[model samples]
Target: MSIDAFAATSLPVRVGVQIAPQHALYPKIREAVQEVEDLGVDVLFNWDHFFPLHGEPDGLHFEAWSLLAAWAEQTSRIELGPLVNCNTYRNPNLQADIARTIDHISGGRLIFGTGSGWFQRDYDEYGYEFGTAGQRLDALARDLPIIRDRWTKLNPAPVRDIPILIGGGGEKKTLRIVAEHASIWHSFSNTETLERKLGILAGHADAVGRDVREIEISTGVELDFSEGLLEAQHALGVRLFTVGLSGPDYDMAPVRRLLAWRDAANA
Candidate 1:
């Protein structure tokens, strides 16, 4: 697909930042969240994990949903959620309830991004089974419907049909789930990968009898934006671009660059 193909839909390009909640204190994470919100990004995210993903394995790290609840109260305007919550950690119904509560807490600013669990350490430490990749994906598939059903039965419905963002690039399973359930599909694909995966996604959407473009395309961009990568992906229909920032410093230079790119693209 070319830029013109996506232009008709004209979804405004959005920028989000995933501030890794490892290797830093909660105060620093809070400060970073406030700063990112002040800078006018579209969304804020923290990963769902019990341990650090990089650097020192035993470094300081915080939980995902708990911090999201805190961030919901601390900031206004910016949408927030786990970059992708692990399905292995909690029951699907419980996940729905938790997301709904946070949705209320944030006054409906929550974007419920989730994926099949990947980090094995989290499962072992938490006493959940560290199953095969297929098993986890199968579990996620079985559970997502239940979550949506639970949403209907809740005391007070979500502030809105809280947008579900599904992150992963598995063509066989993950993309199909995105087709069936996700309002936003987040991936770490560049131009080539995105092009191919989107075709697969379209097929999945067809099987499910929905237009593929109804689901927004989200991607993680590299910090080095000098290469025209952003424009290339935009041409292929990706509107939501996010950058991942690690803790300790939580540098904002790249975030500023992404915001600038977003503004120019939207203009």
Candidate 2:
């Protein structure tokens, strides 16, 4: 898989910021969201988790969907959603309705990123079943179609065909589901891993009769903006780069650098 292989599908580079909702107050989180949106990032994301993923286990954290609804109203330009909503948290139809509602609220700026539920602690604490990885992925496969169908049956349809971003790189099931349902595929992969996964994903897409290049590739970034690293990813068809900022301080410097990189790359 080479960059030229995806050349016919040239995608504009996009930068996103994930504002982690743990260990922070609601007001502070709100302020961070506003600041990032103002900073001109292309997308804004918050993770779906019951508790903090890092640092203190009992840190102050907020729910994902509810905060997304709030963010829909809070920002106007950036597309918003959970970085990857847990599929098992709510009924698929209900998730669809909720996503549709938020899509309407945001006037069509929603990116419905979802995944097979993980994090045993979130399941244990919230009373949802903690199944095996395969089981969870099976559930995700079953529900995605239902979610899409429910979107059609809603009283008021979504303002736009809500873009579905499936997060994960499990080559067997996850990539196949992404082939069938996703508009974007989000993952954390280095250059070699990304190239291999993209090749696997393309095989899956072929099996399902889809063009893999149609799916946008997204990944996270660190503070140190390595030109060589990003260039390698760009060559392998990744266009959407995201950087996550944790609570308390929600630093914007790295985000600014990524934004600048995005502008330069797309220039």
Candidate 3:
């Protein structure tokens, strides 16, 4: 579709929680997912990694897609998926099929967030080549359309057009991929960075003949959920705000605060 074909419209503010599966037991992580969902968060996310990204390198960690399958059966309202699945880890067609299966398990609530792999340890330890960033991105750009096509050829097909959330901030390649295939574009951006990137994304979207506004913008915040920062992002057209909750205890305070903020904003 043309970039201008879709009418500009305001989207409802939604809150997501990334329950980081690190330094915590699997049971605890499961409890955290239930707790966050019960608290009314709009989306639940986990990272696609084999090891902890922070704290002790040997900290407790779990795989993302497997946990997502379990979460699919465990929770009812919240949309769930990896914050970004690594494209290099599995075949793109297999990724599509797995996503489709998860969609059915969730009754159509899967959000297929993916990106080119980074984390060198994940590559080295897992025996996958940690190619240059540009090479990985080129692979990603090639695989995305194949993934989407595979979705169509699946036996039962996805329960819905599973929302594709491409997470990254690379101006040239990543944003172009987002423009071409993503239903949601996720990144970690402050107001100024988001504004500039959004302009660049618009150009890319226009180049691809897709509406930039049609791609939902998602960004993450840590413990300090600043209202001012969020308001600035919201003003710049970001609708999805995600907060990361880590390990062991899985604090619900920030999740509650963001949910309240979402309610207030939507109201």
Q: Model 2 over residues 1-267: C-alpha lDDT tens digits?
A: 333455445889999999999999999999999999998999999999999999999999999999999999999999999989999999999999999999999999999999997899999988999989999999999999999999989989999999999999999999999999999999999888988888888888888998777899898878776989998888777889999999888989998888888899999
TM-score top scorer: 2
Stretches of candidate 3 off by over 4 Å are 1-8
Candidate-wise lDDT, in order: 0.90, 0.91, 0.90
lDDT per residue as tens, model 1, 117-185: 898889898899988999999999999999999999998999999899999999999999998999999
Clashes of 1: 0
**Could you give candidate 3's per-residue lDDT for residues 163-255 as a string of tens digits?**
999999999999999989999999998778988888888889889888676788899987887989988888777889999999878889888
For model 2, the superposed segments whose C-alpha errors exceed 4 Å read 1-4
* Lowest summed lDDT window (length 10), candidate 3: 1-10
lDDT at position 111, candidate 3:
98
lDDT of 1 at 177: 96
Where is the poorest 10-residue window by lDDT in model 2? 1-10
- Taking all chains together, each candidate's TM-score versus the true structure is 0.96, 0.97, 0.97
